[model samples]
Target chain A: MMNCKEATQLLSEKLDRPLDTKEKVMLGVHTAMCSSCKQFGRQMEDIRSLAKQYSKGKQTEEKK
Target chain B: MIEANPSLSASEAPNAALFYDQEFMESLRSQMVKFATLQVQDAQLAEDAVQEAMLSAYQNIDKFGRQAALKTWVFSILKNKLIDLLRKEKRTTVASQLENGPNLQGDALMDHLFKENGHWQKSERPQKWDDPDHGVENEHFWRVFDACLTALPEKYGRFFMMREFLEMATPEICHNEDISVSSLNVTLYRARLRLRECLEDNWYQAKESGS
Candidate 1:
């Protein structure tokens, strides 16, 4: 079974692109069983969303 | 004297209508310098880029034709200038930067966080962060975030920004940097790990205690 460290690494890779079928199932299983990795997934999502808003904030400043 | 329309709110004013005038370019000057400084990491170079961008924009003012937001048009010019500066730096400082090239030495830090079996070390497991929405509302949080980004090794920092802020694709980044796709992925992953840890320690943990 993939451990937390490996699973979290895959989570970051997923951020860059879509995971293949086998990697997807394995990450799904690891995250489903592990609350910590699940939380880490949410955090990556938060960071990416924050990046969008961060740049948008700069654009808003550009307007003035 | 013409009377202003008191009924129309300030927010109702259109930015596009102002693009052709010098007034809008003047307003963007400081903000452009601020953004360029973050990207290029030097106050003098950033100012040069901003000045060059603005001057070029003014010279080509007629070509603007109000087709885009003045801000977007001017910022793209600034981006080009910054890239030109980077290429210049690349040519002149190849020897010094050879040591600073994209590297995977971040593995030492990762090994410390994870054991041989790949489980997270007890001391290194990620803690639950503070409420993210409220966290973003705090100006101090962004200050810390910027500090964390600046702390990253220069190459990793630029690569991360190219991917995150500039939103470049993996292949595009690899081709531009002349690195393998796998190496780029590893570098990006390590960059995220370091950044996340830094932000958690400096911002989120501090928030947990303050509240």
Candidate 2:
């Protein structure tokens, strides 16, 4: 089982690209057991989504 | 607001509805200039690049197939211009060294939060910033977010913009940066870690304290 440290690292990496099967399984198991890492994963997703929107400013909204 | 300003597009091209409208173009220019300034870190140079981008975009408006939003297409043009600017600056500035050198401080900061056993210290565990609408709806939240991003190391901030804002693929980033994929990942990981910590301190925690 990957530790929280390794699991968190994978969580960030998975944002940039797809994890391999082994990495996905390990992260899945680790996050399943670790609430902190799970929260970290969610936050990372939020940051990614928010950053994308924020970086583009309100252009997307104006277009709509 | 733009739709209400019908005079802005009354005498413009048929594609004026697609962003050629004067008022819309003015707003887009300012936004593009702001975005470019963040990436370039120089207001004057950012404005110049935005100008070039706007000219190119206008000249090639017919080439636009409407397959993508006008803003996306225009931003892509601006991004290409910014990349060109960065490439030029890379030769004359310290950007090459910053990109190639070890980010020792980023590593030390991360290590300070975790232990030898690869676990977060009780004091350092990530906290929930549970406001779901903070990033989406609140304009003030973005000001704080921008401050946190500005606090990052310059190279890291630039890299983050390339990957996230410009929507460049990792492989393309690696090739353009002349770094290995693993190296790029490490840089990006450290950038996120630092931004997360900074935002937690300046935005989330501050909000909690105020409330």
- Please tell me which predicted candidate would have the highest DockQ against the true structure: 2
Residue pairs with colliding backbones in model 1 are none
Q: What do the candidate models score in CA lDDT, each in turn? A: 0.70, 0.74
Candidate 2, B1-211: lDDT as tens digits: 3443456452354454655457878888888987898677689999999888876766566666553367767787898888887666642333446643334335586687778788887776888886646444555776788787766776787778888877778887776666778877877887888788777777777788988
After superposition, which runs of candidate 2 have C-alpha atoms over 4 Å from their true positions? Answer: A59-64, B1-48, B54-77, B83-96, B99-104
lDDT of 2 by residue, A1-64 (tens): 6887788878888988899999998899888888888888888988898787765654444453
TM-score of 2: 0.71
Angstrom error of the Cα, residue B113, model 2: value is: 2.0
Error of 1 at B66 (Å): 18
Task: Please state the error at residue B108 of candidate 1 in Å.
Answer: 1.5
Provide the lDDT at B47 for model 2.
95
TM-score of chain A of each: 0.85, 0.84
For model 2, state the Cα shift of residue B141 in Å. 0.3
